[model samples]
Target: MQRKKPYLQPYWWRLLFRANGTAAWEAMGRGPLIPVPNAALTRAPLEVWADALLEEAPYELEDLHGDLLLECYAEPAVTDGTPPVYSRQVRLPGK
Candidate 1:
């Protein structure tokens, strides 16, 4: 697990599961968080697409494994500013 790039630029996709706010029991993301290209992200309105993806995410968390009570629809990982950088993305109005 120590034989890969040591730095992540953010915006890459990953599978994350948490046991608590503290880093007591956590497995690292299986891949590097490389900076996603503008041609690879989903087009906005990001909220709509995100909600749709969230609808199909795996969120059946068990009480003995995780403790984060986030959204209940799907279980999508939150992205900071990634949806604006995806493929075929149109420019948002008003900058």
Candidate 2:
């Protein structure tokens, strides 16, 4: 009998936010990309990072499809030995 391969899901750009510096550092060490949600009142940390990264990135904003945009955020933490925090935000073309 032939076995079927599992369906692979497409990856979307996520906007993650860490309220505190420590959480941000932890997230960075784990992976370059984080998950986020889209909201009007508040912006997620991941959104800030994504925006900054995209600014330096060569990819055109128009390339990002409407379906791929994701925004996320987390509570900030307090602790020593925390790395410096950076913000990134990605705006779709014709915002």
Candidate 3:
């Protein structure tokens, strides 16, 4: 008999970055020099979209390997009178 796969809900997207020089700028009060075009980053896979955000800096895919990191989740705005809640988790490539 085959085991059933668990149903995983697609939680809202977020970005995880290793705290470095360029990342520091985005973190500090430097303002967002590179504006995220839309909320697309959250929906796209990390490997596919992460590079675009790091375009101006020197970054390598391997650089992200085994590094302690910080993640930022762009919370969704609630239109109705409901409150907003954010989800977070430590995600590795190919869970």
Candidate 4:
């Protein structure tokens, strides 16, 4: 049987935020595209990171909503040219 490695394929991510009902969106950040094989490992840290970003003062949480896009890639910048494997959008705190 093949043993599972402690670290698995890294998940790539990019976070974008925009005003409510707006077409314009800006890329706020992206996690280091490193291998993290399991989805369980990826979810918590990425979400925590997003929550932290929203808390930062630079962003005016009001009128802002965003989505976290995640894709599993074996290597950095692989661009397998596919849709994100996972995606979720949330409204930032404030109106």
Superposed model 3: Cα runs more than 4 Å off: 1-35, 39-47, 59-70, 76-95
List RMSD in Å for every model shown: 15.5, 14.0, 11.8, 6.2
How many clashing pairs in candidate 4?
6
Judged by TM-score relative to the true structure, which candidate is superior, 1 or 2?
1
| lDDT at position 61, candidate 4 | 48
Per-candidate local distance difference test: 0.35, 0.37, 0.35, 0.51
If ranked by TM-score, best first, what sequence of candidates would result? 4, 1, 3, 2
Candidate 3 TM-score, C-alpha based: 0.23
Q: What's the distance in Å from true for residue 8, model 3?
A: 18
- Model 2: lowest-lDDT 10 consecutive positions: 20-29
Q: List the residue pairs that clash in candidate 3.
A: none
- The number of residue pairs in model 1 that clash at the backbone is 2
lDDT of 4 by residue, 39-78 (tens): 6555566445444544562354444444333333334564
Please give the RMSD of candidate 4 to the true structure: 6.2
lDDT top scorer: 4
Give me the displacement of residue 15 in model 1, in angstroms.
Answer: 3.3
> In candidate 2, what are the lDDT values of residues 1-95, reduced to their tens digit?
99986532222243333332233312322344443333411433443545655564335444433222232323234244543244343334422
Q: What TM-score would candidate 2 get against the native?
A: 0.21
Supply the global lDDT for candidate 4. Answer: 0.51
lDDT by residue (14-89, candidate 3, tens digit) is 3344343343311222332223334554566543444443442224343343222323334333233443233232
